[model samples]
Target: MGGRRRHARPASADDLLSQLGRLTARVREEIEVQRARVELAEALQRGMLPSTLPTAPGLRVAARYAPARSGLDIGGDWYDGFRLSDGTLAFSVGDVQGHDVEAAAYMGQVRIVLRAVAAMGAADPGEILRTTNDLLVATDNPLFATCLFLRFDPRTWTVRTSRAGHTGAVWARADGMCGVIEHAEEEIGLPLAVMAGEAYPVTEYRFTQPGALALLTDGVVEGPRFPLEEGLAAVARVLRDGVAEEPETLADRVMEVAECTGHSDDAAVLVLSHDGPEACQTAGAAPGIV
Candidate 1:
C-alpha cells in the first residue's frame, strides 16, 4: 500500500497556452499547404487551357470553366478550340478521371496529345480521339478521360462530332428549336485509356441557318442527387430559349444550372454560334475563315 496518497497537479496556464499555440501553428501550416496545392493545380489547369479561342468569320466561339466549390477546386475538366490546317475550327471538351492535382496534370497531357494529333492531320473527329487514346494508353498511367471533339466547317455549316464516354451535345436552330445530340447506347465508345485500341464513331449534323451548338463536360449536368437526364433537359431548355443570345451570354445562362444544382465537380461549357452566310457577307468576312 502507498504510504501517502499521490495527487497529480493540473496543467499550468502557461503549459496549456504553449500546447494550444503548437496545435494552432500545425493547423495553420496544414491550411497553407492545402492553399498552395489549390493554387498550383489551378495554375496548371489554366495554363493548359487555351488563352484565346480561334475565331472565324461566321462562327463565334466562347467558353466558360468553373472549379468545384468543394474540396480543392482542382479538376480534370478542360475545353479547347483551335484552327486546323484546313481552316476548319476544332473544339473539344474533356474530363479526366480525378479531382486532384494529378488529374489536372493528366488533363494537360491529354489535351496536348489531342492537339498534337489533330495538328498532325487527324482530320476525322473519330480518328483524333482514337490516336489521342492510343498515345494516352502508351503512358500506362491508369487514368481515363472522356472527350467530345467537334469540327465545324464554316463554309458548309456542317458539324462532325465524336464522343468518348462523354455526354451528347445540345444544339439549337435559328427557328428556335433545340435538341440534345444523344447517341445510341451501342454507338458510344469507352473513355480514352481503358484499352489499347477502341473505335469512336462519328455523328454529323448540319446547321442550315444561324444557330448555336453547345459542348460541355458531365459535371455541367450530372451531380449527386441530380439526375443526368434532367440536367440535359434543362440545358436544352436554356439553348432553346436563349439561342439568339450572344455566345458568352448563352454560356453564362447555361452555367446557371450547374451553380444552382450545387454540383461537387467542375463544370465547363464551349458554345459555337453561326450567324449564317448573309451575316458573314454583311460583316465582310473572308472566305474559308468561317
Candidate 2:
C-alpha cells in the first residue's frame, strides 16, 4: 500500500499578530475616550465655582481655587460668595468625599441646594446647612461633604458662621496676631449626609479691630508628611507677618505657603476683611475675581 502523504498544519503567526494589533488599537481608543471624559469633568467643576465675588458695602473678598496636580483628577473642593437682598454676604467652602466625576456632580447639587436655601431667607448658616443635609438625605445621595458657611453683615460688622466637620476658619487681627477659630466639641457637628437628622450649630464672631477671616478646605492644612497642627502653625506665622493689603494678595500668600510646604491635595482660600471703624476712610477695591 502507498504511504500516506505527510500533511502540514497552517502557520498561525499572522493571525496572532493581527489579533494583537486589534487589541492594541482598541486599548488606545479607549484611553482617548477616558481622557476626553476627564477633561469634560474638569471643565464642569470649574464652571460650578464662583466666577466673581460680590462686593459687600464694607468688606473686601477674594478667593482662590486650585485643582490637584494629578491631571484630570479634579476633586470636590469649592468656594462661593453672594450678596442676599437683605444685605447679607453669604460665603461657603466645602469638600465632598471623592475625587471623581460623580463627586463633582454631587458637589454641584449640594452647592445649588445651599444657595437656594440661603436665598430663601434662611439667615442662619446652620439652618441652611441643616436644610441642605435634609435634601441630600431625602434624595438618598450617598456622598457626604464637610462645609463651612458664613453670613457676614456688612452693616453691623458681625459674622455668623457654621461648620460641619470642616477645618476651622483663620483670622488675622489688625494688631498682627493670627490664629484658628476654636469651637466647643459639642458645637462642631458631623459632616453632612452622615445621618438624615443632623443639626449644625452656629458661631458668631464680631470684629472689634481691622482684621480678615479666611475660610479654607482641609487640603490647605492636611498633607502626607505634615500634621494638621503644624500646617495651622505655619499659616498662623504667615498671618502674623501680616497678610497683604489686597484680598487677592492675601489669598495668594496663603496658597503660596501651602505650595511651598508640598501639599499634595487641592487647596482653596476665601478671605473677607474689614478696615474697622478706625480705618473706615480707606475704600475697598472694586468687585473682582481670581
Candidate 3:
C-alpha cells in the first residue's frame, strides 16, 4: 500500500502572516476597484441629467433624483427638461431596463439621442418618440427604456404628450384635484428599442386652468413593500394636497412620500407648475422623447 505524503504546513507564523497580508491586500485592491466603478457609474448618471432644469417665464420647474439604496450598481432613472428649437418646453422622465454601470451608460446614450432628435425640430410628441426609437434600434443596443415625453406649448396652454411603456404621469388641477393622466394606459406604446418602427400615439390635453404636472420614474411610486397603484395614489394625494406649494416645495413633498416608503429603487421627479396664462409669458419649446 502506498502511503500518501502529507504536505507540510507553514513552519512559521511569519509565513502564515505574510500570506494573510497578501490576501488582505488583494481584498483591499478589489474593494477599491469596486468603489471606483460605482463612482464612475454615478458620475455618468448625474452627467446625463440636466445640470439645472431649463426655465421659462410662467412655468416653475424643479427636479430631484435619488439612487438605489442597496445596489452596488446605479439605477437608470433620469429626468430632463429643456427648451426645443421651436421655442416650446420639452420634458421627459425615463427608466432604462437595468441597474448597472452599463445601464447608466446606455441611459446616457438614449438621453443624448433623444435630445438630438428633438433638437432637429420634431414638434409632435409621437414623431419625436418614433424617431428616437428608430435611432436607438439602429444601434442594436439590447437595453430598452420606458419614457414619458411631453411638449408644453405655453402659447396654447396645451400639452401634446406620448408615453412609451412608462409609468403614468400625474397632474393636479389648480383646485387641488389630481389623478394620473387620462387614458395613460391605453395610449402607451412599446418601450424604446423594442421595435424599430413602433408608433407612439399622441395624447393631447390643454391646461384649461392654472395647474401642475408631475413626471416620475416608477421608483417614486413603487417599492418592495408598496403596491404600484397604491404608491401612485399616494403620490397623487401628495400632489393634490400640496398643489399650493411652489414647484420646488411640491417636488420635495412628493419625494418625501417615496422616501417614507423606504423605496429601494432609483427615483426621479420633475414638477412643472403654472400660475396661469395671465401670470406667465408665452414661451414655446417643443418635442421630447423619453
Candidate 4:
C-alpha cells in the first residue's frame, strides 16, 4: 500500500476551495475592466456629438439622441446642426454601418470631414456628401454610412437636401399636413463609401408654411416588431396628430412613443421648425441657397 501513497487527495478540499476563490477573483477583475472600457467608449461616443445645437435665427432647432438600452450593444447614430462660415444653417443625421466602437469612431471621422468640407464653402449638400464619400474612400475606410444633409436658408425658408441611402425626411406644413419628401430613384444615392465616385443629387423643398422638417435615423422608424412602412406611418401619425408645441418637445414625445413601443436600436431625431414669413425677417446675410 505504501507503494501507491495515494496522491494526497489533490490537495485538501480547502485548498481546492482556495484555488476556486482565486479564479473567481480573477474573473471579477476582468469584468470590472470590461465595464470600464465600455463606459469609456460611451463617453467618447457622446463627445463626438455636438455639445450644443447651433443657433439659427428664424429657425428653431431641436435634436434628440438615445443610445440602445443598457447592456445592449452600442451604436453609431449621430445628429449635427451648425452654421457654416457662409451663414448657411446645415443640419445632418447619419447612421454608420455597425454597432461597435469601430463604427462610432468612423462616424466621428465622417462627421468631422463633412464639417470641414462645409466650412470650406461647399455650398451644395450633394457636393458635400460626394466629397465626403471620396475622402472616406481615399482613406480606405471600409465602413458605410447613410446620411441626410440639409442646407437651410433662413432668409428664404428654402431647404436643399441630399440623401445618401438615408431615411426620407418628413415635413409638417403649417396646415398640419405631414408628408415625406419624395425622392426619385436616382436621387436616393448609394451609402457613403460604397463606391468611389457615387453621386448624390440635391432635392429642394421650400417651407411655404410655418412647419417643421424632421430628420431621423432609421432606428426611430424601424421598431423591433414592425415593418419599415409601419414605423414611418407611426411617425407620420405622430406628426399629424401634433405631439408637442415646440420642436424639442415634439422630438421628446416622438422618441418616447418609439421607446414605449419597443424600439431597441439607437434613435436620433432632429427637428427644424421654420417660422414662416413672420420669423424670416431676423437679421442674417442672404447666403447663397443651394
Model 3 spans with C-alpha error above 4 angstroms: 1-20, 184-186, 278-290
Clashes of each: 0, 0, 6, 0
Alpha-carbon lDDT of model 4: 0.80
RMSD of each: 4.4, 5.6, 4.4, 4.3
Q: Pairs clashing in candidate 2?
A: none
Model 2 stretches astray by more than 4 angstroms: 1-27, 278-290
User: lDDT tens digits, residues 54-73, model 4?
Assistant: 76766787888888665536
Best by lDDT: 1
Instruction: Give the local distance difference test score of model 2.
Output: 0.80
Clashing pairs for predicted structure model 3, backbone only: 87-284, 87-285, 88-284, 88-285, 88-286, 89-285
**Per-residue lDDT of candidate 3, residues 63-98 (tens digit):** 999988775768899999889887899999999998
lDDT per model, in order? 0.85, 0.80, 0.84, 0.80
Please give each candidate's TM-score.
0.91, 0.85, 0.88, 0.87
Candidate 3 positional error at 106, Å: 1.4
Clashes of 3: 6
Which of candidates 2 and 3 reaches a greater TM-score?
Answer: 3
lDDT of 2 by residue, 1-290 (tens): 99999888766999889999999999999888877877777788889998998876557889988887666476888999988879878999999988888888888888999999998999999999998888888888788999999888777666788899999888887677788887788888888887878889988866666777788987887787668887777776666565547788778777776776566567788988666654323544222100
